[model samples]
Target: MKDTAKHQGLRNQLVKLLAEKGIYDTNVLNAMNAVPRHLFLESGFQDFAYQDTAFPIGAGQTISQPYTVAFQSQLLQVKADDKVLEIGTGSGYQTAVLCKMGAKVFTIERQNELYRKTSVLLPKLGYRPRVVSFGDGYKGLPNDAPFDSIIVTAGAPFVPQPLLAQLKIGGRLVIPVGDEKQVMTLLIRTSETHFEQHEFGDFKFVPMLEDKNR
Candidate 1:
């Protein structure tokens, strides 16, 4: 489906809702407004795309609730030209948001189905990440380490050490860490060997699994 004027209106409404829900980052809100979230969903679900809730995008993964996406993105504090590594590309919706905010995005997806679909869809929508590979999220992207920030869209039982290792000094890694219900956790690499940790309430996400689809 195409991004119509109606879609734009819906997005504006969504952004307004996000702001009301405490997303004060103008960059994040503007990116959220600019990216056509409805386009990332299937045709059948497109109607509900502007809703704040999540919808299944096949492969047992959901396209992340709009609020969750906005919340994580706001926490990231992305700046233009920021090198952001995104774990779990999923629908590529979050990737598009970062891209819209002028970030150089390197994203990983573990599910083959999502990897292929998002790879094609994102570029078609003009949101081309620097690297979009099918891989293990836990490992992050070592070759391109020291990113300005990183975002994990899935729920992890614990923070992946490799992700922490990959952050630049003073860089942020925003992840949802827990079992059934996750606590939104942020780790800022303060120095060569130290990180400051903080938690921002709870959320639910599909598990960040091991390895890629075989």
Candidate 2:
């Protein structure tokens, strides 16, 4: 019961942080609360899980900040049982949030070490999303095409055409875009040939690399 108590405390802290930061969506808050942020961090960093900062998980990658995760998830507007594509699995923290929000997530990781680690950790945490190989996240998951939503955790120079093509009409893609500095962007598929894009202010993220696996 000690673990359960700790989880509850973390959840309360996350809710308080979200409210303080103006994350008003109940769904996003609940998902943030449901997922155990501590599980995604190194053992030594468990105490810092409730803080609003990115923490390293090796392989030069960091688990994204809670606000970033909540903002992306909220922008995607994921519905229960929706199929969502995640570009970078990282430490699987965002993946866990997606799963908790009721998204059927298909995630890809470019770093082999991080991929292997998250693959083992996720199932152990009871929040496994479908894991795929490393490559250009811009390509997205085609076999699972026409997804309900797509989220890219890394910052890209531009929205990849292939990902836009994979979005079902009315589906949304939430990603960070720009070079060096980035801004969170939300793209909505209006029709087979049209899209609407919105910029959601500045954010920093690791550059989205191509073919890190090769």
Candidate 3:
């Protein structure tokens, strides 16, 4: 929970690394630097938290690499106070990033263990989202639909229709789509019945499961 000067220095280096990788969003970078990522990991893995690579957290999940988190956050184009839906809340790292940027986030995690742990850890660190759920995310939080943007941290074989339907007109949905490997895809709602889609490069993610546990 303590963000020592040493931790801040490491985060500064991480920010430069992210900038070199072509992430130019100052808001996103500032938020990244502000959040002490080391606090989000277990003590044993804390030292590597600032690295540009993913590390396993329990329950078959991995906290996304800093680059990935920044990349996705930038692509989502989050405006302050935008209501965003995050499909996976592993480690609550990305959730913290969005919250630091002042987005009202609604996140869902299918792993009960992860959901339970993060549900508690986030607030303790002062990164509270609007809602966190222990349920399948494929259905897309209908009760809180029409999000300004939606970000899926886990890999999905295809875009879930429910997620598309949940987006407000002009909202964006950022997701990785495919199996084994995924193409980073972005969807922007253009009208009541249309969405613009684009794909950029590739990434690997734990599959976004259909059921609570499978």
Q: What's the true lDDT of residue 117 in model 3?
A: 92
**Better candidate by TM-score, 1 or 2:** 1
TM-score to native of every candidate shown? 0.98, 0.95, 0.98
lDDT by residue (1-214, candidate 2, tens digit) is: 0247877887798788888888887888998888888888889888888888899898888899899898888888888899999999999989988998888989988888888888888888888686555666877878878798999999999989999999999999998999988999999999889899899899999889876663
Ordered list by lDDT, greatest first: 1, 3, 2
**Model 3 Cα lDDT, one tens digit per residue, 1-214:** 6989999999999999999999999989999999999988989999888999899899999999899899999999999999999999999999999999889999999998889999999999988899998788889899998899999999999999999999999999999999999999999999999999999899989888897553
Which parts of model 3 are misplaced by more than 4 Å? none
lDDT of 3 at 126: 88
Clashes of 1: 0
lDDT value for model 3:
0.93
Clashes of each: 0, 0, 0
Q: Show the colliding residue pairs in model 3.
A: none
Name the lDDT value of residue 180 in candidate 2.
Answer: 88
Candidate 2 similarity to native, TM-score: 0.95
Output the worst ten-in-a-row residue range by lDDT, candidate 1.
205-214
Clashing pairs in 2: none
